[model samples]
Target: MSNARLPSFRFLIGFEAAARLGSYSRAAEELCISQSAVSHQIAQLEEQVGQPLFRRKGRGVELTVSGRLLLDSVGKSLDQIRSGLSRIETYMDDSLVTLVCPAPVVKGWLQPRVDRLLQEHPALCPIISIDETARYIDEMDVDIAITREPLKQRGVLEVPLLDDELVAVVRPDSDGQPAGMLCLETDLTSDRIGPFIREHFGNLRRLAIYDDPRLLLDAALRGHGVALLSRLLADEALRSGQLRHLAAYPSLPLGTLWISRTEGEPRLPLVRQVFDSLLAYSKG
Candidate 1:
């Protein structure tokens, strides 16, 4: 259509809302504008079309014959525009992935491997957050969650990520004295190594109790005391000889890490790609 012949897009939108709703006041509310604004736009649209679109009836308004025809066309065009915009939104979301996991996992494992994953999948964008309070996985607005608790919800996909041993760890340069033990005050303690630590190292002074694994790991790294740390969390430190595992103490099962998501939700390609990369990295 020529520029002069084309109606104002804004006017058309106002007309569509007013016609579909049959109330200029209602349309104004929907469009977050004043009723007079909707009226003015509809007036401009009628002037452009050379015919009245709406006729004032008793206490309300109704579309005229010409208004009805224009409404039909305008509605369909708006619907198509909305559909196109929705598709674009979905496409944008495909490049973004939101991940939630424990603070320890983020600091110790995922953070270290994220650069590699991003490098391999250049289009991937990750938003990582920590949730150590054991919140329900499905309650959060996250694409993927690495949780310690088993998700029993139906239509949720859960993958076994890691099952590592918890061992007493300390800085290599320390005197190796068992002054105290840094402990994580998490469910992992009650489920896996809590009893073992209590029974074996009960007499030793308690160094600190932390809600986050990163804090406990930090205390151990600083040579404050021995810490019962997951093999996965201490992997890099042990490998580089920054921390030493006490051979005298036997390791306990640390518990399995499960990566999960709502199965019914459409999986974005980037989400799947990142999920697979995380699984592989965890296994390593």
Candidate 2:
């Protein structure tokens, strides 16, 4: 097809809308433009085709024979365009794998390894959903969920990601005092490390208690207090000399981190690829 012979798509769109609705005003309303603008575009389209596409009747318009033929062709073309666009959107959505996990896991684990995963699988997109409660995955639509909590849901594939150990961390220069205890008061911590804290730091005064590990980690980094944090979360800080590990306290075993997906749903190739990458990264 010759490029010069092609009609203005804008004009055709206006023409089709006006013709289909039998009212230029209604078309303008649907297109969010002035009624005069719709009329002007239709007039331009008619001029291009060398024939009137609409006949003014009362307050509305009627399609002429030429208009009817053009409307038929334009409608089909626009429908095809819409269908193709919809397919593209679905494909983009399919390329994304939604990962639901706690905020600490997102900050401590996934953020560090995400760039490498993306580099390896250029076609895959990972969407992170942070939920500390770990209850939303079963209630909401999620492709994969990582949680320290055991999955009670049936027909789900669960793979062990990491065995997180809890350790007391503080800023490099600090007086390890009882008043400098920064406690993370989450359900997971309460269940796993509560006894450990009582047994070890029973006389220690709590500087602050946080429900989120990320917040606890932040407080510890600022030299507010010594925080009992996941080894994974404090790893970077410890390695870089940003935070120092207190030698007096013993490390407490928290639990295993597990990545799970619904079993019945059709596992797309991209989802599998993302899961495998995450598994490998966590293991490493």
Candidate 3:
């Protein structure tokens, strides 16, 4: 139980490398030092242990009984140290929360309330990224995800965030006659919305087509044309009188938006808090 006579880290590192590689020169090359340094360190380790750890072989070196025993303990220690460092790096900034959201959700929903969310939780550091395809939520390291579809996987908890409907939105100040139609590509691909638009509004000129509904919302706000977009996305604008539901077209039923996080015990309380806050915000 004497802590005073422990071998130095440098000696242990040199010893482990030399014993594993069976060559002081190879250990030195791996350690980015000269063979003399490796030899010196190992010699010091041997002096401290009061036993010779290596034996001369034909061209390389071989581990003696003591050397092999030390290497086993030293290698395990190094592995644990490396794993500890990696775990520590993740906690260096606990306030940092990563979120992956679809572009439409980010622009129309999250972007508008970001200022208020921070005001409520000033210490929170949010890193929000757009993942329209929802790839990062399943494949990458993220704290929260908002997607059009729910993720049903082990250890993942997904809940409905908002129930939305597809509607044609136009600027409030618009005269009865609009310029053209602005459409989301996905809406046009939907079985219901796609065929409905073609049958009813086919006579109207198509001004612009966009893959992202955020873009369609923007174009509608700018008076470019009538935008076929989700009501959830246009809610802020509609409430502010910047945009209005085009009364001529019936609102088509869209689906529920989902908010998801890993199930069971949470790593960070802030992630759970933020997730709950978002759900509450959506309901409000």
Candidate 1 lDDT by residue in tens digits, 1-284: 23558898999999998888889999999999999999999898888888888999875689999999998899999999999786557546767777888776677777878889999899988878885454344423567888876777677789899886888888987784688888888733585566788777787788688887777888888888988898878877887788999988888876788988767544676777787888888767
Query: In model 2, which range of ten residues has the least summed lDDT?
Result: 132-141
lDDT of 3 by residue, 108-192 (tens): 7788888888987788999788855543343235778887777776788889998888788898788878888999787778788
Q: Give the Å error, residue 132, model 3.
A: 5.1
lDDT of 1 at 51: 89
- Scored by lDDT, the top model is 3
Q: Candidate 3: count the clashes.
A: 0
> Candidate 1 vs candidate 3: which has greater lDDT?
3
* Global lDDT of each candidate: 0.81, 0.79, 0.83
Which rank order by lDDT, best down to worst? 3, 1, 2
For candidate 1, give the lDDT of residue 264: 51
Candidate maximizing TM-score: 3
Q: In candidate 3, where is summed lDDT lowest over 10 consecutive residues?
A: 131-140
Q: Candidate 2 regions off by >4 Å?
A: 1-28, 31-94, 132-140, 175-179, 186-192, 262-266
